[model samples]
Target: MAETNSSDTRILMFPWFAFGHMTPFLHLANKLARKGYRITFAAPRKAINQLEPLNLFPDFISFHPVTVPSVTGLPPGAETASDIPISLSRFLATAIDLTIDQLKSLIKSISPKLIIFDTAHWIPQVAKPLGIKTMCFKVVSASSIALVLVPARNIPTDRPVTVEDLASPPPGYPSSSVVLRGKELQTLLFVTNPFGDGLTFHERITMSMKNSDVLAMRTCHEVEGNLCDYIGSQYQKRILLTGPVLPEESKSTLEERWGNWLARFEPGSVVFCAFGSQIILEKTQFRELVLGFELTGLPFLMAVKPPAGTTTIEEALPEGFEERVKGRGVVWGGWVQQPLMLAHPSVGCFVNHCGFGSMWESLMSDCQIVLAPHLGDQILNTKLLADELEVAVEVKREENGWIPKENLSEAIKLVMDKDSEVGKLLKENHNKWREIINPKLVNEYVDKFVQSLHEVVG
Candidate 1:
């Protein structure tokens, strides 16, 4: 390889084939590009069009579209996890794995200073021979990594990992507050299941982290320092923090229809709920969730995907629900501008699935938080926000992980009620945290993170 100029060092970003992973990778790319570093972001060809508008620094950051070769059982044109149901994610993983040769060619041609990735565990091996350093940048919270992915969670060769094994944290795990309970333990079963070809999701991520030259997270030390430290100790690799990598302020405005709808409500009275792109609730659960919002008797705007086996949000609504909540509530099937909606003064309470990205967005906004986590990482994130930080409340769940409408209603009321002591305390704590995670502090983390990248590559 020809010697590259230090001033012209470019960083390559290749996240797993999922929107949750890819979106954060791009956010960090924007941050690095702002500091004058060029970034080459690689993702499926189809996803690039969707992600293009988010490329704020298009002059400094460019997209490389990788064609996902078809794999058995993978639906045609399903380039991302969002395109298919959760059950078929393994097929997407396999398809992404098949693109290794294309990626290797890209790496050889570009010869970037470093490659940052998650879940694509082969990156280090592929980049090492090309003289490119690799960083396994985890977009999920460090607490989730520490809780399950660390080396201490011994994978017994004699027997498969059972729910019993996940009931408590592994020995030397970082925090007691992040444990999973009841049916939530079932979510971790995917760790042991085959993700792509022969590798399980756990194997894939841990191998990526284990092989990378460095490990980093989209979090700051103030919130998860101990968890990050524990991961570092177990992996024996240096850990870099990116301080949540919050999105830059947008120049665009909320859509006029949404703006007009929200304007009808008083400030701090409307409840806005959004689960991330991946969650597709069952019909019963979907109806229960909307009914929960109605039971609160508060105006709400729910942006959710259609329920399983349903064609539209309207089809899944409980009988008489539309007429009952008619003018005060809206159940939107399509996407809504989440950050802008959260920023709207009328949106006082945010009920979210607690994905890491949404967690940061909620933390930065003025709205009171209500968590309804649907996955392993999300559950851990909920624990961090509700239990560890005490800045949010999680809705109560049954033994089967079903959230009753009454419980959801009560959780919302706990945060939205003006006179509730819990609501007051949560608001105060959230404000303090919002101040700590301000843009100034996040920029400082990015500064240090870039400095570390330079040192590693050099």
Candidate 2:
């Protein structure tokens, strides 16, 4: 790396192929681009479709596409960002084998001073031998990271991770609203993780992180300083506290879109329900959720997946449910915009799975929460979001750990009750957070992160 000013560092960032992973990095990328650092953002073509538009508008940022290979265990036609299940082990091996040569070519062209990449357990080998300086961009919060570090023996591997385990505070970090789930547990406990040449992968990721020069976390200091500090100490890495990188939604447009949702509602009149893109509620469970939303009599908007072979929302829904809530409730198989929905004034509360992006947007909207976390460290996120954060309520679960219809209805009512003591506080705190998490301030941090990279590499 040649010595240069902070303005000179060129960075190559590889984000995980999921929405949660890409969102924050994009925020940082935008920030860095604004700071005059050159950024070559690389990922499987599909994984970064949302960012390509920005690249065209700014000379500082460029998209570098990599082809992810076909893995035998992955669903046919699986792209890097596809939510379909692929054998993690096989997926990592196959994809890395195909992309390594391509990545080297990209590196030769750009000669990035630093490579800040996603912290997947299966992705270290490509960077290790190239003498590329790598930083671990942990897309999840530190508290969630701590929960993921919990030992395998502590989890009940027989079923879904529960709110019960997440409620308990783990040692070595301050508590968070989120808890660890089977997904994070599974990733951590993998006996044959794929990051290394042919060995188990989790151990490799742990080792890589411990030796990393920098650790960029998707967290704001207000709620997670202690946890972040502990993480920094353990890993011997410098901490960079970057707030949640929200999707690129304009606030005025958000305000306008939300204003429309509000026109149909009275003050504090509606509930907003959505699971992140990765979730697919089983048929029976999904219907129960829709019915429960109906039972509330609250005008709502839900983002649901279209049923197989269906093109419209009406076909996927139960009879009369759509008509009864017609105009009052709107259902979309998928909406291109979500941040606008949360920021809408009529949206008084949210029922969500606690994915980092959804959780951050809900909080930023000043709405109350109804937690329904699934997979990975989300069990932890759900627990903290509802139980400890005092800003949300946890949806009740059955003995089997699923969120049942009766409980979902009851939980919604509890959070929306006019006289419920918790409702007001939750809303108040959420507003305070939104104020602190202004997009402008977050954008500055993003710029500084990139600028610093340039200085270091220059």
Candidate 3:
């Protein structure tokens, strides 16, 4: 145990409300559980239930749920870090104060040694005065990190909108594996400093990690060694490449589900499509996607998000679209067990928004990708996963900044086409990756992460 005893080291992990943000932090909380660290994870009471299965979350770790007020303009019933809106600024303006108040009250009930946070960098402001150390547990792609800090064009500069010199070698990384795309740009934006807020915010975030203490990632160096090393040097912080923190239970369930689903199909057949949680599609756009997917003449399972901000699935769906595709497709209105869905044997390819966490999860689960990235750093991740790794194909984009139905359909067909080279290579890589990454997930990924904590507080 780190700290004074097995029961003493308590982590106060406050993840953002988006499911993507919550994914890695909770996996980390569970890892800490195996190591005997007590935890009081603070978030709205509404959000904790989705993570209920994690209740087996070891003997040492425990949850502390808080209620977020029903504020206007956010999602209805929105409660915790995982349910908050995607607007970084607006969400932060509301969430920071509420989260601090919630945490402060929770702290009165249980004081702990460390506080790990993601999304909102303002957490250090609240934790520092309390004598609690804060670790910025940002969910990022290691390749994206390398590409961002490589003395790129328009990076960290006023009036610098385009990324340049991103093709430069990622520092502390093997050059042979380093790669970037011609049109793709790296992200200089982040949770707190999305449009160059100021040197103050970046300095605050970077300074928080000046220590040799772990600046862990949601990746494993074994799979992305060059990218990992590049990040460590760029951030100037100790790097821990912990693989994607996924639900352990979901893995078993997926094996069962996939085994069953595969029974209904030939080997190497279905295509899986899902935009991660927090993506709200317009009704018109949703209808177009349905048309595209149906036209591809491939078996698919889509985890669809309901419309937010005056949009709804029923309104967006094509007339009788659900009925026509009845037995062939399954579309859900909310979050699905993503990793499990992707890893199914029947699933040969994945369509994603290029969220790094989703990308890593798909790769780890042995699913080839058909990427359709929208806003945020997803564009950056798509560049790395689609262009650099070459394990995925980019969905064609429209002049309007989104892929039309035709392009989307074409991309999926290419990725899943039995006779296409892209499909063949992706399938080969998928099997190889499944073999390579499994050992880390089961054998040593979580253990190394826990070891770092024990070393720190012991």
> lDDT of each prediction vs. the true structure?
0.90, 0.66, 0.64
Whichever of 1 and 2 has more TM-score, that candidate is 1
lDDT of 2 by residue, 1-458 (tens): 21233364578877766666766676677666655667888877776676565442256677887777776665665655445633443464455556667777887888776787764443345555666667778776566666544232144545655555544545655554344444344433442334435534444445556655667778777667777787776666677766776655553355455467667787667888888766766666777788888888888878767643555667668887777887787776764456766666677778888887777777777677888876555665666566666677778667566667788888888879878777777777767767777877777766566555644455
Q: Judged by lDDT relative to the true structure, which candidate is superior, 2 or 3?
A: 2
The residue ranges of model 1 lying beyond 4 angstroms of the native Cα positions read 1-6
Give residue 47's error in model 1 in angstroms.
1.1
lDDT of 3 by residue, 1-458 (tens): 23333545878887766667765677777766755678877765656777656555545666677666554455666664335545633544364445567777776567667777754456666666777666767686765555543322123444544345344543455444334444433433442244113433334344444432457777766666777776666666677656766655542465455456545865556777788776777777877887888888777777777755544566667788888877666565755667667656667778888887887776776666888876546876776666556677888766556568899889888877769887888767766766777855644877777777666555
Residue 53 of model 1 has an lDDT of 81
Error in Å for residue 244 of model 3: 2.7
Candidate 2 overall Cα lDDT vs. reference? 0.66
Q: Whose lDDT is higher: candidate 1's or candidate 3's?
A: 1
Tens digits of per-residue lDDT for model 1 on 1-458? 11133256789999988888998899898888877778899999888988898899887889999999989999988889888988899888888889999998898888898999998888899999878899999999998899889888766556888888777787788688888777888887778877899888888888999999999999999999999999999999999998888777888899999999999999999999999888999999999999999999999999999999998999899999999999999999998889899999999999999999999999999999999999888998999999999999999988888999999999999999999999999999999999988888988999899889889989
User: Candidate 3 — which residues are off by over 4 angstroms?
Assistant: 1-8, 67-77, 80-85, 125-131, 149-213, 251-267, 308-311, 440-442
Every model: Cα RMSD to truth = 2.6, 4.9, 4.5
Choose the strongest candidate by lDDT. 1
